[model samples]
Target chain A: MLASIVNPLILGISIGSILLISALGLAVIYGAAGVINMAHGEFIMLGAYSTYTLQSTMGMPFLLCIPCAFFIVGIIGFVIERNLICYLYNRPLDTLLATWGVSLVLMQSSRLIFGSDVKYIAMPEFLSTNLELGILNFSTFRLFLIAVALILLFITWFIFYRTRLGIKIRAVTQNKEMAASFGINAAQVYSITFAFGAGLAGAAGAMFGALSIVLPTMGMHYVVEAFLMVVTGGGSILGTVFASTLAGEIQSIFAFIFNDTMARGLLFILIVVLLRFRPQGLLSTGSGRR
Target chain B: MSFTRRKFLNTAALSSLALAAPNLWLPGAQAATSLKADSPIKVGLLFSLTGSLAVPEEDSTLVMQYAIDEINAAGGVKGMPIEPVIVDAKSDFKVYSAKTKEMILRDKVISIFGCYTSASRKAILPTVMQQDNLLFYPTCYEGAECTQNCIGTGPLANQHSFDLIPFMVDNFGPKVFFVGSNYVWPKESNKNAKVWLERSGGELLGEEYIPLGSSEFGPVIEKIRAAKPDFIFSTVVGASDIAFHRQFKQAGLKVDKMPIASLTTGEIETAAMGAEYGAGHFLSAPYFQTIETPTNEKFVDGFLSSPYGKNGYTHYNMEETYLSAYVFKNALEKAIDMHGVTDVTPRKIRDAAAGVKVEADVSPEGLVWIDGDNFNTWLKPKIGQCQADGSFKVIKEAADHVAPDPFSIYPDSGKCTADGLLGLDGKLKVDLI
Candidate 1:
């Protein structure tokens, strides 16, 4: 009984970590720009596809493909932001619709190129093995995911709190006019922030593609959870981390008690209830509206 | 007002000419004579060409085209060319219903062949029945439904589970666990599976359902480990299947120790996962790509060489869809032969569609025919182990074609109970009531 209880808890933590990594990018972009990027998931999809192409065509190592995916998706995101998203800034509704349109185009483009067939990236042999702890056994790939999530969280935190770019981004996010008055180029800051967020999504995608099937529409699967995490976390980096971990643990526990379907249903209900109480979310940064 | 005799005579003559003019305008005799032998019989081809299901359903469309090409090449259906009116459902059920209705009412298609999923079929079923049209649906599904207007050219749950459960018990162990996508097909199929488990003296350890499109299987994997079931029976479909297999393999669960037996895994899934991760998983289906026969070889070669088969992965659903076309063609020819060309209607063709035997050569599978009673096809179920080359190696096959039992009423002892054992409260209580 103890083993059963402990195993699901561990699994839940792992799940939460994955959700955290996937949602971090959305939170960063949405919180900073107040642009609900509907295409964030597609960015992740592009990252996964990039990893697949690199590994298959160029025989690139799986480890190397992670950064490569980030860079590739980051460049794509930068271009999209400059050409499309920049025009719709401050117009949230238009931005949402535009991003959605971009997502559809990306999905169709991928289908045309990849032919709608599912693809998989082979993980390293060592990572494929399970780590059998006393009464708790989990896959190393999941452990790696958790570790990556932690590393990414730290990196994101360091960037925001410790780096110069982080200060510029936060300034622009908090008061764009004030930051511009202070001689900070808010446009460049927004562009860099969007690209960085997309790069994070790309990294998440690389991890996810290894974990699941890579298809044209695979982004939709992760995007929902990512959005939930962002909304529940109140669209902040630290808040998202907390929300995802809580959500993941709750889901696993509920699933363990009931079933997977019921767990998901219950999770949604809980999120709704939480939102009903705290409309601003678990942690409100107030960076969204302005 | 009519005073003169000449005026009255002219009025009578004009009235007679008006009556004669109606007859002259009506093409009653000419219409019959104008029945041209070269006219094409329009058939609606409805399947998802875009969206999530496009990957698998696209192949079904290709197979339909392949069948149409072959039939037309061989002097058409009774020398009248088959004009395919194709439409993409886009993986939406509402769209499926609208398309089916439009094809029947607007295009006046003689018959329609499409729908890969049960949901889409159910959506279009009402329209097909109400419109009194024939729909040839070709995909193995959780069957208890029998509709006269719709002909199922795929195996039912009974045909697959009856053969599959026993085979797993005999070769693997009596202990089993079940996992599937949360849907009607998986839920109903698992219910039947529970019945089969009891009949074979096998014990069901646990059963769980993940939401459709769920990628995470960590908690479920842990649960399976704790239960220590001898084998897993997975009905998880689409992207979820890929996730489950990859996770199962990555978690170092050896197939030899506890292999997975699936109803949904096929050539496409195997290819997607590739041999390294996918091999050793067991699948039970009516058709496999690796079937070695002269006819199958030719069909496979022809399809692969065709432009539509560039992907080089022909799934069981594709073959089933291909077989549906031939079944429709055979029934169409029979209907035309029975009722002369002018007298043929949807009802007449549907009546003739019963027990339509498709020769072994036309289908990759051998000796497929529709059962007149259930409207499901009589299929030979085969157990295949995935090979490294993204193909199935037939480990076992049924001795003969298993008759379709959509209701599973036959072999009354094997009848499924209402309890699907889907409750998540605890492990399944396998004691037979």
Candidate 2:
């Protein structure tokens, strides 16, 4: 029995790792700019597509393709911020609506180009093969994803607390108007921060693309769940990570005991209960409610 | 609107260039009005590529394109050429309605080949029936959507599910429990299983349904364990299946200890469940790449050779849609050949379909047969268990072959095809098989 739970736990951990990676970027965007950029998923799509185009089409190796996919999508995110999300900073929900329209356009464009069918990214031998140990098995590519995600998570923390760019970004997030009065480049930081968040989503998508098919609207289920994950994880990097792990573990156990439907139902109920108790999150350091 | 032949030629040349610019626009499209006038054949390749249903839908459309390639290469119906029109339904019923209307009203397509979901099929039938156009629905369906206007390329659950019961009972002597998503497909599938069990004198320990897309299946697993049923009959779909298979694997139940006979479990869903998550699960479907047939052998080869399926997929619909295109081609040719007419219409194709019979190389069984509703019969299902290496083993035939019935298993119960279902109790008055 103990042996059996090992696999689901690991699967949960993989799901949690990506959720945390993707959600933290959104958390940072919110923490800095109160705007929820709904097109964040499209950036992820862009990243996956970029990876697929490079690795599958241009025949780039998986190891080299990751950074390329991320940066390309991040640059696109930056362009999107400059052209679209920059001026809408003051109106949060309006930003949401605008991003939603942008998301539709992006989705439509991808469909027009790729022809509305799901596309498999086709991982190479190194990323696709698996390692097994007494039923607690892991895919080689998935392990690579975890390693990358963890490294990024640590680097993000280090930047936030120990680096100059991190300090400036934080200052803008803490009090954007005050930071502006102090002559910080708040708008540039805003653009950079939004692009950075999108970069994270793109990275996650590129990693996930190896695991699943890349459909244009594939992000719908994960996007909402990720927003919830960010909130439950306390809306900070550490908070989001903590919440995602917590949610992941709970979901695994419930799914282990109940089934997929009941597990999701129970998890939803558990989240509601947690909200009633903490209102902000279990590890929350912020004022907002997710 | 008067035009000289020179002007018409210039206008046509420009339009052809525009259509030719995007090669992917119509994969198997033929542009030739070089023949006689007053007769046309329009073919619709309908699929969901942009929206929610694009995942499985991509394979359907791509494989259909391959079939159209084979048909057009063989010289289209009466050699007048095949015009392949694209319809991206995008997973919306309203969009499906509007596009289908456009296909019938505007394009005047003689036949349509697309749609995966039961709801999408149901939504399009009224429009297709009203316009009296033929539709070839190429997806394994919930089994109740068979109508005069539609010829299903997909298996109804009964043919696969009922056949498996007898085979599993013979091989494993296992007591059975039913588990599936709480939806129409599973509900109808369970109904079919119940009838078969009743006929076979088999024991039915329990039946249950979980909400679709739910990730927690622990309590149900516990109940199955407690009941100590020897096996499970699962009708779960897509992601829910991955979650279920993972949980069951975690519970220390080996495939041999408690075998699973499943309806909706296929290569597409199994592979997506990932090799580790869904390893060693059994499925019953019309065609398996591993099914011993020269045709199937070539099909698997052709699909893998293509860049789209370079990574390898257990796409059930891809095989079905490929065969369906062949089915469409044969039916159209038979109709035209018999009548000696160049002007092909939907009515002729539908009439020709009734008399047309074609054999499939891809079918698990040797031949493909079509009943009154044009649902093909030759491709009976076989059991295939997923292997650790992410492939499947053909567990041999449940019978020499299983038959498909589009309406009620008891066909007479649906002289009243009221709402695509009979009343409660599900007691069909006829045996369609």
Candidate 3:
């Protein structure tokens, strides 16, 4: 019984870490930019496809493809923001609609290019093996994902708290007009932030694609969980991390007790109830209201 | 204009008439003789061309077109060519239902051929029944359903799992774990599996279901490890199947140690998931591309030479789709001969479809014949193990055709019902040759 409980707990931690990594970019963009970017999932999909293309066509190593995917999707996101999202930022509803439309366009374009077939990325042999410790057996790729999630969290924290660029971005996010008056280029900060968030999504996509088969519609599968984590976490990076961990643990425990379907149903109901009590989320950064 | 009773009635009548205009324009009662002999006989191709299921459904569409081309090349079906009105369902059930109605009422297609998922088939069933149209469903699915308006041209679960479960038990160990996506096909197939496994004296270790399109299998794999089942019986379909196989391989579970026997995995999946991930996996189907027969050789060669075949590899679903189109053509010819050209309706075609047989020489799969009562086909069962090259090496095959038992009544009750028809207890009366 104890072994059973311990195994699920470890599994929960791994799943929570995955959720945190995937939702990190969405949290960053929503928290900092105050724009509900509906195309976030598609950006992640683009990252996976980029990794697939690079690894399959160019013979790039799996590890190298992750970062390459980041830059490719990040640049695409940067251009999209510069041209489209930048214009609709003031109107959040319009931004939501525009981003949703952009997501559809991206999904269809991917279908057209990839021919709606499943593609796979080969992981390194070491990552494919399992790490067995007594009663607990975990996948090495999942362990790698957890480690990457931690590193990402640290990097995000360092950027927001330690760097000058982070400070400027934060200032802009707090009050764009005031930051502009103080000589910070708020538009540039927004663009860079959007690009960084997209890069994070790309990184998530690379990991996820390696975890599963990459397809044109792969984004839709992960986007729901990403949105749930972001919304539950209140759009703040720290909040998202906390919420993902909590939700993951709760879901895993519930699944262990009942079943996966029931656990997910219960989890959704619990989230609704939690949202009813805390409409602003678990932790809201008092900015981006306007 | 605001509150007059006569004006209100007029407006309501006009709106109702506008809403009913589309249905009123339906040419349902039109005679087949009205179609010119030179003009093509319109048939609806309602397979999903886009969305999650497009990978498999695209093959069905391609094979259907190939069959039409084959028939057209042979001086047409009695000199009347078949023109397919293709519509993409986009992997949505509502879209399938809508398209079925549109094809029947507006396009006035005589028969439809398509639907990969059972949900999509079930969604369009009501529309097909209400419109009195015929549908040739070409994918193997969970059975126990027999409808007059549709004919399933693929093996049912009994034809697949009954022979497979005992084979696995005899060769492999008895302890089995079943996993599948949380859906009708998987759930129903697993239910049939449990019965067959128990009958074969195999012990079921555990059963689990993950939501469709779930990427994470870490917890499930851990659970399977704890259970230590001899082999996994997987009914997991679509994207989840790829994820499970990849993760299972990544976890260093050797296929030789504990192989997965599946009803769904075939050439298309093996090709997509790569040979390494699927090597040594087992699959049960009526057809495989690697099956060496002169007919299959010609079919594969013809397909490979064609433009549609260049898109991707052919699988069991594609073969079934190809077979279904031929079956429909045979039935249509018989119907046109029995009933005059003017009287060729869905009912006539369905009536003539009874006992319609495609001989071994023409069909890629040895011999296939439609059972009129159950609307399922008699197909020879073959169990194969996947090799490194994304093709199956047939390990076991039935000596003769296994009759379709969608309800699995033969195994449940030990009575032989000579003909290939259902007995009193909703079971197939097994005929001993």
Better structure of 1 and 2 per lDDT: 1
Candidate ranking (lDDT, best to worst): 3, 1, 2
What local lDDT score does residue B273 receive in model 1, on the 0 to 100 scale?
Answer: 71
**Whole-structure CA lDDT of model 1:** 0.84
Q: Candidate 1 lDDT, tens digit per residue, A152-186?
A: 88888899999998999889888899999999999
- For model 2, the docking class works out as incorrect
Question: Which window of ten consecutive residues has the lowest lDDT sum in model 3 chain B?
Answer: B412-421
- In the order shown, the candidates' DockQ scores are 0.60, 0.17, 0.62
Task: Order the numbered candidates by TM-score, best leading.
Answer: 3, 1, 2
Clashes counted in candidate 3 amount to 1
lDDT of 3 by residue, B206-289 (tens): 888999989777667767777888899999988889889988987767788789999988997887777888999999998998
Which segments of candidate 1 are over 4 A away from where they belong?
A: A286-290, B1-37, B409-433
Residue B273, model 1: Cα distance from true site in angstroms = 1.3
TM-score of 1: 0.91
Write candidate 2's Cα lDDT for A1-290 as tens digits.
Answer: 65466766765676577667667668777766676778877777777777877876788876677778778877888998999889898777889999989988888888777655445555555554456676455556546656887987876788788988888988887777788899999999988888877877788778656555465775565577778887776666778888887777776667666565566778889988898998777776765332
